[model samples]
Target chain A: MGYISLDQARTIIAAALAHGGQLGLKPLSVAVLDSGSHLIAFERQDGSSTLRAQIATGKAAGALALGLSSRRIGEMAAERPSFVASLGTIAPAGLIPAAGGVIVVDEAGRAIGAVGVTGDTSDNDELCALAGIAAAKLKAQNA
Target chain B: MGYISLDQARTIIAAALAHGGQLGLKPLSVAVLDSGSHLIAFERQDGSSTLRAQIATGKAAGALALGLSSRRIGEMAAERPSFVASLGTIAPAGLIPAAGGVIVVDEAGRAIGAVGVTGDTSDNDELCALAGIAAAKLKAQNA
Candidate 1:
């Protein structure tokens, strides 16, 4: 299992926040998980609505579980709404097929976890996740 | 505002983990949310899936937003599938209204924040959350 420490989570969050601040974006909610898709840490900025973190984590988990990016899931869902609906029935709440989540791959290119961001455009969310993964020296591991 | 700082969130997670260990539960995923429903922190045991935290937080946020437990939402959903479906459509993902979440109430009985736990039965999740709140000395902030 890819060991994920809280410190690393903090680093990823720090990077995301810095980037968001640079862009003058809205407050963001981020979720970071270990290689096994277990939570390492999370943070939500002030003024962000309660839904932000849930959405972020959902995107991240969807990537981790699917071994792909949530953006891919979004594309797939767009093509098959009914199937995605069934998936919602089976999956936990907040399983969005959005573009803000990407799987994290270790140095060996093995996916260990994922990072997700919310409270901005889907493109921005995905960008933040990718940047955090890169800062950690991990691959995108996106599908 | 039920100010649930990251430090408090960490405390809640530790309390939840210790109790879960004592109870011989599988690894748990815990979520702590502020009054605004934004996530303050989360932790998932090594073996837990990424979905746990998202599930737990949604359960807790649903409770806070509606001022009712997820259990109550389960019953309500059965009677109003359309309402629930629209909820899913209109709200970000993770809007499941289910059991296993408790509102953090202050001395004035105001709901300030909430803690949600998963990777266990709903009863166990609720117990762990209540224990966390107690350990944090954050008695139900708003009743």
Candidate 2:
């Protein structure tokens, strides 16, 4: 299985931040994680809230843990809140049922990594993640 | 059960790191925990992954929780995946189900504490834990 390199992680973060800036969104936080949900890189912009780091990492890690994007996880949470809540307790990085998390896929559609962005509307955050992935020339699974 | 002192915990960490260096392994993180599974000391080398600290602690804490080495827990996970996964939800530190966690024993063969190392291969990590325990003049439960 492929993994997200530190270089690609940095590029994702930079592009995500740039996209958020262009949209005039609130201070953003971005996290990139490998397939195992281990953090490769993370950055929270100035004035971002204290919990941004956890929230960002949680989004990406949660997506990887469940083999679904965080947006899909949010839908699952809506359908079965208790089941999703139980999983959050078990997940080491915790789970954030939101739209900002997107899985990065390889040529064969196997998950390579994930990216999560926070600090704006969930939809806006997700847009930034997509923009970042596009800038890095990586595929976003089911995007 | 006896507890590991802060001084001894530090010694374990230092010696573990020294051993990793001698072997030219990747950057490592070490955690020393008391009999109660409370952290006594921790150290993550520069350039180690972001989850190193949590993984290290989880290894040692998982050992204490099941009263077996983390290596054995990994075997249990392989044999009974769902059972081990369920326990991970209840475990506060989370169970990693991997090697590198070793339980330290007192003269009477009772558990005193535990040591966990991470960063390189699981076997290499376990070797570092063993080296640390020996350097501290402690005995591993099943070494």
Q: Give all candidates' CA lDDT scores.
A: 0.76, 0.86
* Model 2 spans > 4 angstroms off: A1-143
Candidate 2 per-residue lDDT over residues A1-143, each given as its tens digit = 57788888888999999999899999999999888788889999999889999999999988876667899989977864543554566577978999999999988887888999999999999999999888889999994
Candidates, DockQ: 0.32, 0.05
Cα deviation at A101, candidate 1, in Å, is 0.7
Tens-place lDDT digits, model 1, residues A41-140: 7877766776676688788877777677899999989999888667756765356888988887766778877888998999988788777777766677
> Candidate 1 lDDT, tens digit per residue, B10-108?
788789879999999887878887776767777767667657766987878777777766677767899998887677565542666665677887776
B1-143: candidate 2 lDDT, tens digit per residue: 56678888888889999999999998899999989888889998864534577778888888989999988987777677677778878889866677899999998999899998988877999999999999888999994
Classify candidate 1 by CAPRI docking class: acceptable
TM match of model 2 to true structure: 0.60
Model 1 clashes, total count: 21
| Model 1 TM-score, all chains together | 0.62
